[model samples]
Target: MSPVEEVLDFLIVGAGISGIGMAVHLTRDCPGKRYAILDRRDQLGGTWDLFRYPGIRSDSDMHTLGFSFAPWKHEKSIADAPAILEYLNSITDEYGLRPNMRFGLKVVSADWDSAAARWTVVTEDKDGKQGRVLTRFLFLGAGYYDYDEPYDANFPGRKDFKGQVIHPQFWPDNLDYQGKKVVVIGSGATAVTIVPAMAKSGAGHVTMLQRTPTWMVSRPAKDRFANTLRKFLPEKVAYAITRAKNIFLQDLTFKRARSAPDKVKDFLEKQLKEHLGPQYNAADFTPPYNPWEQRLCLVPDADFFEAIKAGQASIVTDHIEKFDKTGIQLKSGQHLDADIIVTATGLKLAMAGKIAVAVDGAPVDFSQHYYYRNCMFSNVPNLISVFGYVNASWTLRVDIVGEFVTRLVKQLDAIHAQVAIPVLAKEDEPEAEDIFADFSSGYFQRSKHILPRNAPSLPWRINQEYRKDRLDMRQAPLDDGILQFRRVRETVDA
Candidate 1:
């Protein structure tokens, strides 16, 4: 019953992959160091727990998806949702992580007390009981997928002619589409995945509606040679080869699209045409820019095409004008009838929603900050938001950050320092016009002004390249002007 034992050394928010990964690392490396993982859900695996949509799977292969220390032992590169969840559960059990987790505990806010040199966390349990925890440091492993569907298509409709209207994120458990016509709105990953599965389940008809075209690159879920190599050679070697190959192809296609214009894209369209046949046009599905600008949605084993070929699904390249009682009215003077309307219109980006830091008890407005190295927020003291690569497996970058964080924590202990904060100079902040012109979608754009900017941007500054990150995050001096450190606090027992 010691008060000090009650206070943990570190408080990690979210028990998902990142949170669980951080816990495993800290516990294994530091040993007996007090740390607790808080998650809002009743169970572990944030997205894996929340998303129960059909055909849900990882975009990247399992080789790079799993932790560096843990290799995914599966024959196929792309795995289904249940298998992924099981894999995560096994890790949780193997590491004995459940005991360290505070489930159904949602963190309302985190405030850093400068004088105490500690973080004060306020949490509300599922039963509405409020409790507080104090910790020496805080790490946010809360991922981007926390929020549900941002905008439910509230189209003008007659409530009188109702059939079920569902979003894939919150799909109905008793929803039966057998021999029923279905229309999935949006061309993103969610919609693409849903259409095929619905078709396979004996749905009479399924159609996907897209407002804008997206780059849909369909490939086999399993690569034979790579899988065989993984069996014979070491897992790491096989993973490295697969990762390198994917990276090379991604970069090559991106460079060709950006530098060589429509030539390469046209070639891709020709291939698409050959596969999709005469009635189906590829241009309706091709993207405006090069690949990797925005992440390309991965259809498992080109299942979307298979659905189309089987006459189970089709695509409508038009906007929905309004909703009738039974179906939707498109702007192109077309009426599409359906018994179920599934809106999979992508996600709304939120930048570090779980993190709310205050200095000396004043709330720090993170949106005004610039990102430094895309890891640490500018002018924010003792905080880092870990984001991964767009081209490769996200976990790869996360694992690197985990290692780096451990190293940094160890460094602070060695130096007798209490705080490590990112310090951004006024001169480093890019102008408004420059920022608006350059920044893209998702987390990057959401944190644009506050994040660190590279001069002569684009090809030079984009953090997609791993070597630059290694230089900035690993090789850079700790005492550099970018981050400031402060001394540890001592309390008198007199």
Candidate 2:
């Protein structure tokens, strides 16, 4: 170890919503601790800054998506990318966190030293310059998806027809699609968002081509209740009430979908009928899986349906045979001629932000280890990875995780402990289950092997229920028997 190297009390990865939220907690609760935030991108907003695709907006309401410490005062609950980014920027300004942020730095790997009770983190810059940071605690808020690559469907004969093939992840700037035919592949949120955007923005015609149907629900862009409350109450109070109401509705809907799928399906069908009217096709809208099995795509203000009704956008369900010079040829003997093709297939999931992790020179395989408290992994000391809920807003989990991590840090100081780890005894090891088995999304299914093990019960599993997790993480004892704390004396060389 270099004598001049500075060791931080906390080193947070990723400058996205999760990382920003974590930073807020550290500033408020552990004010005396030294910490910094780093991200691979040049900008702070992770997903919001990366993708420049049109009609990009939050699927969940801003009341739930915004940080707990901040109040989203915008009229639109389902805000566009710019509004969300502005909100994040405001938080940084209000909390004075900008000085501690380091951009264009990617975490390459992290190795924990038991003797020092600190993590030596390796990082790389945009120019391939290597750097290292020492931190007593490592917090990973980099998110769960692969930032460099999106899931590739690898359509046959891609080089032959291509006018301009694009993935939503890497959207080309100022690409002209006006008065030209556009075909967007996949039926997920990206595709749904892009189809209406392109069609309404001046594409001669847009068609959503999908192999399978995805469950979709539409609500107004603005929240009337939230807006009314804001007029009469303080901004923070109104935000709190709005956030609580949305949380309850979200949880209730998810529970209803699980308990009575048929009823949920019928309700969705009714909503679709109201939105699409004469253009509604039962076969096209109906999905094979139950509602909430995969995330239900949110269509704000029925824009997608409006585009369809106006003869600007359409949906085609079929298998792709291959791509021709003009467009895609469907297995059903139909050809889609297009000037632009958008592949909104899906994202590729990753673990630990693709950072190679090791403990005492032994590499850590996250799949073999069990998740403890949905934040830390078994036997991993002084490290916490923030993974959000699939059914609810991602920020909901972020808030609870931030609170829990802050409390844990304070507890370590109170006990004068150098390291804290969750250790599972051989006799107490629970049956291993797929962490995201309940969600049948393609991304989750594709990356199951790389994820950590989850059990059926709490403290050993990653729970999706935000309400229960919030209570347990905030109220639960940090000195539980499973989590062993130790004091280590630093060894100095003579």
Q: Candidate 1: list runs displaced more than 4 Å.
A: 1-6, 145-149, 158-161, 425-462, 491-494
Query: How does candidate 1 score on lDDT?
Result: 0.71
How high is the lDDT of residue 248 in model 1?
Answer: 63
Please give, for residues 53-140, the per-residue lDDT of candidate 2 as tens digits: 9999999999999988899989999999999999999998898899889998888889999998888898888888787888988999
Write model 1 residue lDDT over 326-403, tens digit each, in one string. Answer: 899999999989898887865555446545567677877765665555556666566655556666667766776676
* Pairs with steric clashes in candidate 2: 161-325
Model 2: lDDT to the true structure: 0.92
TM-score for every candidate vs. truth?
Answer: 0.89, 0.98
